[model samples]
Target: MITATPRPSATPAHLRDASLVDPLRVRRAGPGDAAALVALSEPFVRAGALRRRPFDVYAARAADFLVAEEPGGLLHGCLALRVHPDAEPGAAAAGVLYNFCVARQRQGSGLGARLLGAALTGARAQSLAALFTATTGSGRLFLRHGFAPVPQGLAPRAWARTLDPRRGARVLARAL
Candidate 1:
């Protein structure tokens, strides 16, 4: 139920026409948001920017997601943080960030940053030791947020096994 503070109006000149809405909120995703989450991720799936995930996948992992929503309940973006399953009790957890996407029209309006902030906050709340993400494109956004390029082998084994080598994904990590 953490809410983002209102964004400033200091948008870059190129994005002056951006439909940057105020009062945006980031919250934990619930079962009811499954469809919207799928819809939000569809374009990325088609573009191969993200792997396709069925509605049932979202439903089953709903608690692992965070969504950016407008006052009227329209979803603006979504991010998922998957905690690695521990091999033994009391081991510190690691996490994988995936399925991050922003509404096409809102792409340059800072919604991604808001959603990322919320997800990171949630990760810290869960006491994760570090977070990892794989990106097919540039890792600029994640780098700016403190992530550093790392060998794929450094990722949690369960998560690394899920990566597709053909995707040429660059692995990045940030310790909490």
Candidate 2:
């Protein structure tokens, strides 16, 4: 069984109180959640909201993810905090937050915020010096969470190499 570390209930003042409508519980993704994670991410992939990652990728990196689940094992959202492969010990670790998705039905709800908060908390716990991400649309949610737009050249080389210029993804980063 995968255990989740409970995060503080404090919500960012800029965001709505999603807990008032439907509270969320965020937890680390376990082996069993692979299929569910892929299922939740499919719609975003189809809509071009996110890149398509194979099942093997999700399975291999399950430990790097955090999921927001509702009562009765229903998963509402998920995100991945991928640490830079070249990060050296004692140096500021770098990571990228990617594959973030919330169910279409629950988009307006607070599940996204809860999931993001959990990811940030996880990054902090890991002592990451910076977190980065790419978005194709307006980045209001990320901006609200302290992320600022940055040039693609400033992103980690590995991440920047994966960018498809045609998609026009805007890179953003936040220093911890």
Candidate 3:
């Protein structure tokens, strides 16, 4: 298992105190974290809540992702920021958040909100106007954080898949 360096809690006390979720240490992901990342994401991948992405892809894109590691070096959750590095500057600085999963034992423990905050912080730093994601569950969480459903045709292929022909997806975006 990959170990995560400890850090102060990433979430504020108010949010942490109000929920059943525990605190987490959020950090940038590294190549050594690929396997853990894959494992953390499997449940969603199998349920079609997340796309089938390979471990190597996580390693390759480690620079664009973040992980919430518990004190013991175990990965509780992850969130990735997807965007083309060379895309036009004025195009709203788009990003799609993917592979966000909290360990089964840690679900509902404020870790997801902390991860989302970190990703949104990264997006704003990159001059992104908004951050987007698709959720099969937790629509309320996104809504609580100011995300709203985006119209069809506005999302990319990966994101559009969230809107499957068999079962529709819920798209949400938050302006940074």
- Highest TM-score: give the candidate number: 1
TM-score of each: 0.85, 0.84, 0.77
The lDDT of each candidate is 0.89, 0.87, 0.77
RMSD of 1: 8.8
TM-score-superior candidate, 1 or 2: 1
- Each candidate: RMSD to true structure? 8.8, 10.0, 9.0
Compared with the true structure, model 3 gives a TM-score of: 0.77
Candidate 1 structure quality by residue, lDDT tens digits, 1-176: 99999977786776553244356788999999999999989999999999998899999998989888888999989999999966668888999999999989888777788787788898899899999999998877798899999999988998999899999999999999
lDDT of 2 by residue, 35-154 (tens): 999999999999998989988888999998899887788888999999885445566768899999999888877677888888888889988888999999898899999999999876
Question: Could you tell me the lDDT of residue 68 within candidate 2?
Answer: 88
Off by over 4 Å in 2: 1-23, 85-90
Query: lDDT per residue, candidate 3, 81-170, as tens digits?
Result: 886332455566567887788788877767778888888888889887667787777688789889999875566555555556554667
On the 0 to 100 scale, the lDDT of residue 136 in model 2 is 94
lDDT ranking from best candidate downward = 1, 2, 3
Runs with alpha carbons beyond 4 Å of true place in candidate 1: 1-21
Candidate 3 global Cα RMSD: 9.0
